[model samples]
Target: MTLTQDAAAAEAAAHPRRESVYRPGHPVDIRRTVGMLRRGPGDPTMVFDGAVIWRTVRTSRGAATLALRAVGDEIRASAWGAGADEALETVPALCGAHDDPSGFDPSHHPLIAEVARRSPGIRLARTNEVFDALACAILEQKVTGLEAFRAWRLLVTKFGHRAPGPTPRPMYAAPTASEWHRIPSWDWHRAGVQPPQSKTIVRTAARADSLARAFRAATTGDDRDRVLTSLPGIGVWTSAETRLRALGDPDAVSVGDYHLAHEVGHALTGHRTDDDGMLELLAPWAGHRQRVIRLIFASGVSEPRRGPRLTPADHRRH
Candidate 1:
């Protein structure tokens, strides 16, 4: 059998015959989208075996597992569970089928152009899971990646359900919105989640339905931004992070991120810069700010590390 045919058979057996294939017009690296789905190394919802990436997610129907792999120029997706159809349907957008870089002239900026030239396969990924992405962003508020990921692992492991279908390892699906709101304060504390962050998630989940509706109705970038930021505790940074991952929005720039400005500054100019400075530098690339930033990161340009690293606070101790 051809690789494509083999993959189709593997998928059919796994998901009651629900399978799909997608080929990008340009080169697309599967791992580039990994960061969008993965929370941390210990994330129980996602697993990356040597060959394929297996992920479990909760849909309106039920829990489902999706196995995704890149075969030559095509991406093969298979899934199982009551939500298998919904899960498989999302494969294309998740694999960059919706990415449009039209009118984005890389030649205008030498640094960005060079990065794009070197790695022509980079494509932004979108999840379209609003509540899950919002909840994850909330946990990441005012914390180091390690701290947030640790908290996320604890939260999901304790409250989430076992993954569906055959997987490389035991996996879990993130709890539903109600489950998040129902978690006791002690459990949140035990998970090292601060009160503010935990409360924000609970409140966000409380209006999850309305938020989903608003997102569905929103047609413009401004509409989406307003809907996301209207909720308490969500700001420019958090909203941008959510939009970039959930919607694959090219214009969402994480302006307040800790290191983004400095990295962009050093890559575009010769020195580090503040948020205002970075915004000034990126003004020309208004609609593609995040794309430009990703390119800068892909270029491996970073500001020199000086001063002590951020200490991971033990909220449980407090």
Candidate 2:
């Protein structure tokens, strides 16, 4: 009943074919697929360290489970699922799977290069699961992260199925679109969701199937943005965030974040910047804005200002 055991069972059921491409004991890390099921606070998920081995991917085609272990200098991959072989073949594309240093030429930008060199573990976080990402984004609308996380935990526990695998920690499966729609208003209140956010979730859920199709069909930048923004409550920022994870976009700038401008400013110029300042600072790397931001984040240059932390407000107690 452990995550690893559950994963082993799922792998066995799927009958994965193995191939080696990475060396065992080498540094390997797979970004957890956002919204994939995991046990609660008490449980843990088992992941490979040293060498990048074993990743669970949910894609447009279906769930694509992969296991990678190190062998000499090469990394081997064992993948299985509805489209196992194709998914495995597409792993590199899905995972930015080319040589690590190919597109990210650090030499062009001294700051980026230094950051990348220093923190090589900051690979892009991919969720391959569009609906889950969208749902989570919806939950986060106009609320503190604590509120969102609390609601997410409650909703998932109430409606999400247990993730299949032997994960070391407990995690909840993100609720499916239909399941999200089925959540009663009272439950939303209990989960600490305000009426507005709750309505957005319901609205999105009703059109989930259509949105999923549109997301898959969207190939051009304009087309993708248009399709995502067509939904209620899915504006520029929300759509951008969802597309960033769902499509693994490298340049999606989070424009409306409360902290990003300050973080970017602190990292770039030792002062907090507004959205305009943040955009101006990032203009040099337009195509790779998010990547640069990631590097700045990895660099760990931002320090806390001498001020009180944002106080948490409990609407339930209000």
Candidate 3:
């Protein structure tokens, strides 16, 4: 490479582009909002340090490292890499600027009312990167979170591009859709991902571009779910998860989650309930079901454990 090109690259690396958004009256907790996107505590794509949050994202232009910190009334954001500009442009939405709670009446339930009162800064975060959200959502399908997080860590650390800026630790953005589709079967197996989950990712990766466009253009949560579930292996739960993270759809409910129904029911009714019952309980909130769910989770309410936690099945042993 030419010396001029090398010097320019070095200069860019030394100084990241910066932008800040003022939230005069909006009280948004940047961490609580964006924390949902994190798969697990050891997630390679995101990290938290006190009031600051750092993450790596794959944008249409390229990969970027984004750092966000919330001061009194504004959120300070900075980005580095080829996609820095695009990443900076999404700062508002990523910090929950577009997540309106106008129609949500948390008073419908006393518990929800109390929780919402205590946590007024909570807002749904939107990444606006559908493929990344979809890929991770597919990994989490029908598996224990430990298993899903392990597979995600293994695959991303191995295949993703190295983040360009100075980060709290070594971080990497998710692999591009084409790269995800090319992951060999053996690699997936070694990562402890069963064939079914891996195959779904492959199929989804093949149509990532068109899928992103369709999801963005979808006018309603149901419409987005239809487009996502129409694809082979994508289902209602996965579609809901994708919408929650990518589109910040507050109405999205992960109906088929293993523990969610029970947790919500236990928290609200003091007894376990099935998915149908959970839906019925949350129905009163209608357009703000997901917001209500978030409040419940944040409230740290859960059903009493009757037995030891279920162990994750290790497919690699087979």
Candidate 4:
């Protein structure tokens, strides 16, 4: 079978019992959209492994709940509440239909072809929920993911509203911009956030709505980067990292990452390289540098570890 055929078959086989009540103007294949993000294993978030399928969609009145799962031959989608139709329509867009490869011809570029081969399921998971992404990013600043996840879980459970849906599991809505501003320093500390990260989150929350709109307007890497960096505490690395998922930017290389330099170096060359070396190696694919990086990562080439994993610190205990 051709690669495209294989992808379609895999998607169909992945979700068999398709069920959705979303009456949006157009027919949206949730199974196909979810399939694009279903990497086999080893993904940090395990977004494809059936975890993290519960997401909430917020509206002016409140929020709706949606659950996604891969059932045989079709994706099972369930929604609840008056906003179900709106959530259904908006969910696909949030999941990155806008930047999906269905609109792009991968045959035009060698790098894109390589990426498509290595990571057939990689899609831009555009969470149009700007405040949620911003809040999560803030929790991740200079901290281990475990630490961030812990803080996120605590904050959501304590301050966030319960998601409206029929799902068995309780999914907490990420705090809105107004709620984020109301969270006191003590509450953040109790949630294991450091002063610096908390400050950044508070400052950014003030303009979370506006920044999200700016990102939606941005079409190029430079445009997105410029708008993101305009916000306090957002830098090149943060902007690039966010744009990778938010805008599905093909060339948004993360220049200030803590481990990407080493990972890129190891994948491209025999030894570790600095940020400059990584950039030099990737210069050939300037327009598609991010795509190249995703391919190298999806190629499943792990760098040999010389030390233990970074331990997450509990600032509250400290």
Per-candidate TM-scores read 0.91, 0.75, 0.94, 0.76
The residue-by-residue lDDT of candidate 4 on 163-258, one tens digit each, is 654445556566788798889889999988998888888888888778788888987888888987887777888777777655567677888778
Model 2 scores worst on lDDT over the 10 consecutive residues at 35-44
Q: Give the per-residue lDDT of model 3 (tens digit) for 83-178.
A: 887788888888787898999999999999999999988999988889889989999998899999989999999999877776788899999999
Model 4: lowest-lDDT 10 consecutive positions: 38-47
- Candidate 1 lDDT over residue span 1-318, tens digit each: 999668646655755736888777678877766445799888888888877888886888877888999899988888887788888878878877788888777876899999999887777888887888889988998899999999899889889876667777778889999999999999999988899999999998999988977875787667887998887888878888888888888878887888888888898998999999998988888788878887887888888898999889898988
Please, what's the RMSD in Å of model 1? Answer: 5.2
Q: Rate the local accuracy (lDDT) of all candidates.
A: 0.83, 0.64, 0.89, 0.65
> What is the lDDT for 284 in model 4?
69
| Error at 246, model 1, angstroms | 1.0
Tens-place lDDT per residue, model 2, 255-285, is 8887889998887778999988988988876
Order of candidates by TM-score, top first? 3, 1, 4, 2
> Each model's RMSD to truth, in Å?
5.2, 5.2, 2.8, 9.8
Top TM-score hit = 3
lDDT of 4 at 79: 55
Query: In candidate 2, residue 315 scores what lDDT?
Result: 65
- A best-first ranking of the candidates according to their lDDT comes to 3, 1, 4, 2
Error of 2 at 90 (Å): 7.7
Q: What TM-score should be assigned to candidate 2?
A: 0.75
